[model samples]
Target: MNPPVPLAKLLPVPKDLTGRLALAGGGLFLGQWFLGDLLHVPGGGLGVLLTGAGVWWLSRGSTPPRFQEPASLQGWIARCREVLDQFETLEPDGGVRRQQLDAVVQRSGPQRLALVCVDPATCPQQGELEQALAGAAPLTLSVARPLASAEGARTWPTVLQEQELILFSLAAPLLAEDLLWIQQLPEDQPTWLLVRSTAGESDRHCSESLLAQLPARWVDRVLVQRPDGLLRDVLQPLRRQLGAPIRNLQDTRQRLLRGLHQQWQADLEQVRRRRFQALQQRTQWIVAASVLASPLPSLDLLAVAVANGLMLREMGTLWGTDLQPDVLREAAGQLARAALAQGVVEWSSQMLLGLAKLDGGSWLVAGTMQAISAAYLTRVVGRSMADWLALNAGVDALDLERLKREAPVLVAKAAEQERLDWGGFMKQSQQWLLHATS
Candidate 1:
């Protein structure tokens, strides 16, 4: 017998029919010449013809069919169909299946593929599913574990980053923490939960429980695989589900930021309100002290008006409104005038005298009455500005008469909450008074 031809040479046939026919005829002629002339065999030409025909048939059978590179969604689907056809011939093994999946991903260009094994021990069709997925396609498979523990929770974000398509196998009931962790994952991640029914529980009951725990918007698709069914039965549906490309990480980040923005806005409002209150108290004390130190009565009102205007503008900013300086000044003037007209100045003097008596009368001095009056007016104006800002921002509503009545009560409540630092207030008042006069 002639030396055996190389296995590689025999495997792949030529693309065109003409090339295949020529190869077959050439092989027949060579075989006939070798057997008939050299070996002197009877019916050598027919034997050689039969041998050549057999070789041609085997070459045709072994040759891998050529496929065009997919450039569109439909083309990609066609390519997937071709891969599925090839998968039909592969044996169900991990290595073989992994290689096949890698091929598909490579062709598709570093795509993410999630292999969700629902209770792998109970699901006998996992091996078949893995084998069916193995092809020349480029894909990265991430086997997700239940995030019930701290260690398992750490793996959650890593899986999201590494895999594009998450194949989740839901064989058991999800815990509250697990459901929470899954909900926290990027909303754009295309997740397909492969839910397999168990013998202990009814399928409908189990599916309903799972559905209730999971956010409807977060899950892209829910595929139910029966315990009696084959894994390959759902392969076609899986392919159809993966037809759409995975959403980009940037898009996922944007969506996450948007979701958090509303919460952040609320937190920021709380911080602003706290800051506004603290600053308002401090500003009132400074304005009161400055007015007390001022020799002119007109300068006392001017200092209070300036301090109140600045404080009101800041309050407006905290409430998400940009109040014009003129508007703030007008509001401050109205509140300051109302406080003076309501005899708040006389009441404040009597309160301060009592407070001074409690403090060993060190605060009882020549301009103490004017300082008390100015301080009271400052507190009233600040409280009014806060209420007006709240009203403008739709947080609260109050008419002028109601606001005027509430002003003294709010100021008194604020004073009761925290003691005034008399020494510090006097020092701050002196500095502010000096600055204003200069």
Candidate 2:
């Protein structure tokens, strides 16, 4: 969901002319201060023009108009095909042994359970595991001896192939690495957690917290250890599950594939988000340099609009999306309007001007303030666009009104998030200011 900030409250224009005048006034002063000499007299008029243009655009923003999606029926069909291709890429069996999946489907016999110990301890030993499974008749229990070690992870999977279920038996204090490693495992393979947590919390309580890092399914078949080195399964859950009258081996295969798909989705999202952050930093710098070279905020913001189109196109490529280029520009326009309405430029001018009022702020320039704020705007716009793509990924088509409706929240959220990183922004901007002014 987008932020709770209301769309109606976030108007595209400033509430009063006074705010614009104040912002323009600040820029006007900075403009004359930075451009001095005999020409300084006419520089005031130049400042008025620059200030008015910026204030006009900021308060009364305009965006590119929305375009109809997919030029023709064939284009729409092609998009559907692309969506299908992306869906196939998300298949769980991706990057794994296809033959192994087939082997899992063909084999059938006594239900098997592959046991793994995440946290290894020599106390309970293999003898204790066999004793625990003694009552589980018509079941094969293959404990991965010294699990997590090179010898165990190598041979464990083939010995694992015969099994329909896995029991992760943690016999010591759980560490962060256990969670990281488990993330790579299959999601749909029938799972059971056997945790030997230390004293304090009750078995059930400990079970919940212990498997918190894992999927909720891990908690379902949880078998917590007692002080006597026996599982506290009052219902004989393990024995009953293994000795059940019937089983669906195909369903087990489906579960394995299902888990694979889920893992693929998670992995894909992580990769895209990382790329987005990198792109944001790169684009922000590009926009900031343009803003610095051309001190007119309106022209610099126009440059930002062009940059957004390219950013949105790259973002679409990242997500395997097929929104038309025109539609992306239209989306960029909507975001630009929302961003300008947020009044980041005027706010930045005020803040920078306020800093200059202090005794030590001797090096501040009008161009410096405008350049940094433009960079800040790029950050906000890029973050908002990324969220837009994430929220609407895999949709059948683009909805312009939907993007417009979502704009307020997306822009508001991005601005709020960027504010948290203000110190970093200031530090970087100060370095840029010193180099540029020097």
Candidate 3:
């Protein structure tokens, strides 16, 4: 069954202004305050013009208009088709086989393959991988096994010799040590390190240190996670749709005047602002939800969600769109409901088990949140979240508390030892989330 959509979750139309003379006087005074006191300007003429325009626009139209794209129906349809094609390539069992190195070679162009080993016995697809690449033309494959000669050591240079590319498809768990070795290796060739990550497995919380160690140059092409197998087919189209801005949001005056049979540029701009804000809110929600791999209580997940939300909201504001608060609230509620219904609790338990292997401290939780937060929040929003956290949750304004809380849970603990810091960390994170997005 489709999840229930609550009426309270709907975006609301703006209310009409009443008490004309009083309202006008108040607006005039507020305009002066913004221009003279806040902005430190001489007179309020510019403020008056802007304020009057805004009010006039809002008063005529109760809600912001919807955004439209620049393309016509045929153009948009073609774009959608293109997105579908790219998405199909990532699907599991989608005719693309790991044993068929030929497909990868063909797609990436005629280049030599860089092969690195993590001991065949410990490698996940050692035999199958070798067979696949052997037949592909114009490729030089080199192999090197991790040495047992030293305590916890692997010979890095042996793999670099005669190879123009490097591949890491190891069976062993990816760790910071392995990543550091890869980073230290000669960078003459473009490297393709394959791992078992997909969009669905992001929250598994495996070796993030490896992600942090990614060479700055290759960040864009790096496959952080695979697209969702189930949604892979639709992923590109979805991405395109989300990326496109709504047309009405960009030209509200035109949209509003079209309905009223007037040609007022002032009214059109106001309408544009409202629609833009709505677009921002929706985009924010989509980005956050797209990254989720079964929801967790960890601050990291929430931070990502909030960052996406904030970015969307800001984008809309810049375009003169007014984001509907109710839509945001409703979308959030839907997501929360979906997670609860889908047995996300079990998923969180599994993720926690995986994260427990990382050795870290009290600041880990906060640090994770900071990373996710930074991904979405621009300077303005980041400072706002930080300040809100400090004021409301009694958290350090610097966001260092994440480690104090989550790290201990990840620490090795005896069966009989109960965790105390766990509860406090969760509370702090929840508090910050509420304030940051509310």
Identify the superior model by lDDT, candidate 2 or candidate 3. Answer: 2
lDDT of 2 by residue, 1-438 (tens): 223232235333343677556545644543454334211223436455664454344443233343333443344344444443554554433634444434544556666777676556622456666666676666666767544546434223544534677776664356665655556455545666666667665776776676676676566666777665454253268766766524635455444444333444455666678888888877777776776776444455456556655777888887776666766665665676676556554555566667768837555566556667677878887888888777666532456668778787788898888888877878878776666557
Error of 3 at 5 (Å): 78
Candidate rank order under TM-score: 2, 1, 3
Ranked by lDDT, top first: 2, 1, 3
Candidate with maximal TM-score: 2
Give candidate 1's whole-model lDDT: 0.51
Give candidate 1's error at residue 95 in angstroms. Answer: 46
> Which residues of candidate 2, in runs, are more than 4 Å off?
1-259, 295-298, 395-400, 435-438
By summed lDDT, the worst window of 10 consecutive residues in model 1 runs over 58-67
Which residue segments of model 1 deviate by more than 4 Å?
A: 1-140, 143-169, 175-193, 200-205, 212-221, 228-242, 246-250, 256-286, 293-302, 311-354, 364-438
Backbone clash tally for model 1? 19
lDDT of 3 by residue, 11-81 (tens): 12223345434434444554454334432334436546554443233223222223343234343333333
lDDT by residue (1-438, candidate 1, tens digit) is: 243342223322345787678657755764464334432334424466664664354234221122233334444334343333333322223344335334434443355665544234533344566675655254555555434446554335543544556766656566454455566556656666777776667657766777777777734366666776566665556665444444333333333333233333344445556777687767777776775676643344446556665677767666655445545554454454344334455455555566668877454453544554566556656666665555444222323334335544444444333236454545655565455447
- TM-score for each of the candidates: 0.41, 0.48, 0.22
RMSD value for candidate 3? 25.1
